[model samples]
Target: MRDANREWVFAQRPDGEPDMDSFELRESDVPEPEYGQLLVRVRYLSVDPYMRGRMRDAESYAEPWSVGDVMAGAVVGEVVESRSDDYDAGDVVTGNGTWGDYSVLDADSVAPVDPSIADLPAYLGVLGMPGRTAYFGLLEVGEPKPGDTVVVSGAAGAVGSVVGQIAKLNGCRVVGFAGTDEKVEWLTDDLGFDAAVNYKQVDDYGAALDDAAPGGVDVYFDNVGGPITDAVFPRLNVDARVAVCGQIAHYNDEGVPTGPRKLPQLIASRAKVKGLLVGDYVTRFEEASEQLGEWVATGELGHRETVVEGLDNAPDAFLGLFSGDNIGKQVVRVSDPADD
Candidate 1:
């Protein structure tokens, strides 16, 4: 174990969009585990869009981070010291952890990682929270059915990618909206999305949707909200189900985002729009995990990850999310696993 630890701390709140000035890397003594806790050496740190919401000083499902507080997110790590009977030294686990080389986590809070299932970082992506989000959010909230036209925004992203694939498995016609042509091809060619629109290249999203989803959208899994979502609203089929996941398009906005009132369209379509928070389905996480793991193991489900090296670059990885820098899950590799 190292004698010192390096961790990122929230330096100052951003006025609009955040940059390096928003974080500070600090060195401190390595934390020791207390009873019912374990000291883990973080291997991979997850950088997600939802973390951007936590940076703001506002009331939300997740508690906001205060100035000078240690940055926290999901991490896959190996236990170096244990004070609980459930886990032993060298056991790999994942849970809420600080953005640092080492973090002390409650044993009860983390789940053991099976490297045999997939790569360690996969625990932070496809086999972890993001996968679970796509599974429960799409199935329970979206309620896609056979022959339904399912549209996913940010379709190349961690959650959105899985949403499209799962919709395909449910016998639905999947159409996706992505930023790059490469991502669009990956969705349509590799992931089996029936159609994919490169929002960056398309001058008119409504026209793109007209060509891609000619039958109208029956289920809309929205990860990026804004113009793309605006186009989708008018194309909703009757009794459409819309799962509002992440609204990355406005995460960094300083003021209220002004857009076309979508309620009228919602009324016309009689759509059921619901916001999704993965934590709300915590009790059923094991069920989702098992099903997702089975799909991943059998090669029925596919996933990708964008990895940044070192803890120092964690802030950069996170900031990149707003700019749409990742094709799939974005993570920072702090260190390699012991067995690796």
Candidate 2:
């Protein structure tokens, strides 16, 4: 049995973009599970754009991570020891655990993970939060119809990638906006998107979006909300649905940055734009998970993972999200599940 634990904590709040100095890694003694707690041996930890919001000392849907607190997110781990009747030693589980090698968490906080359905790391990604985000945000909020032109921003990242694929599954003509030519090709070739634009290479984003979505966008899934979103507004069709899942472009801003006043476009097009949070559909998670799992199991959906090995490298994996360094879901493999 392991006797030591390593943890990453929020050292300081970032200004614009976070750096290595923002985190502090420390070693500690492994914790014991209490009556209703289980000792988890972490295998994989998720790194996401939403985590950037938690770094700031500001008010948001999720509370900000206080300085010196263990940075936390979705984690997949195995039970090294258990004091709860619900779990046993060697059971694989997933929950909102910390960025640590091991954690003693309340038994009710975690859900059993079936390695038979998907790979272990997948529980932190496609079979987990990102998949749920895409499912509800695209279907419930975007409400795409058959043959509609669907435009998705950040179309190559975890949630965005799933959003585009789900749009295609709904019989929509999917157009994607991504950072690089490689991501564009992955979207168009591997992911079956009708069209994809490299936003970074395009001289004119508006013209590029116009070319990709000639019929005018009927559904817009906005993940990176900034200029790409500004470009999409003018192309919205009447009664179009826009699912605002994220604004990653603005997550690092020192203050709220003003952009094009595009409410007039909404008025002219009679479009519907609403923000989405996956947690809102907690009651229907099983429905979404089953469908997403089926899609994964049947090869209808392709999922990718960009992994950084070792728990000490977790901060680097997290920092990479802002710079588009990952192809799909970004996760840190703390250790092999069988290592324990």
Among these predicted structures, which one has the highest TM-score?
Answer: 1
What is the Cα root-mean-square deviation between model 1 and the actual structure? 1.2
* Candidate 1: Cα lDDT at 24: 99
Candidate 1, residues 122-196, lDDT tens digits: the string is 898889999999999999999989999999999999999999999999999999999998899899888999999
Model 2: pairs clashing at backbone N, Cα or C within 3 Å = none
The sequence of per-residue lDDT tens digits that candidate 2 reaches over residues 157-225 is 998899999989999999999999989999999999999998888889889977888889999999999
lDDT of 1 at 217: 93
Which stretches of candidate 1 lie above 4 Å from their native place?
Answer: 338-340
What C-alpha lDDT, on a 0 to 100 scale, does residue 309 get in candidate 1? 89
Specify the poorest-scoring 10-residue window by lDDT in model 2.
Answer: 331-340
Q: Clashes per prediction?
A: 0, 0
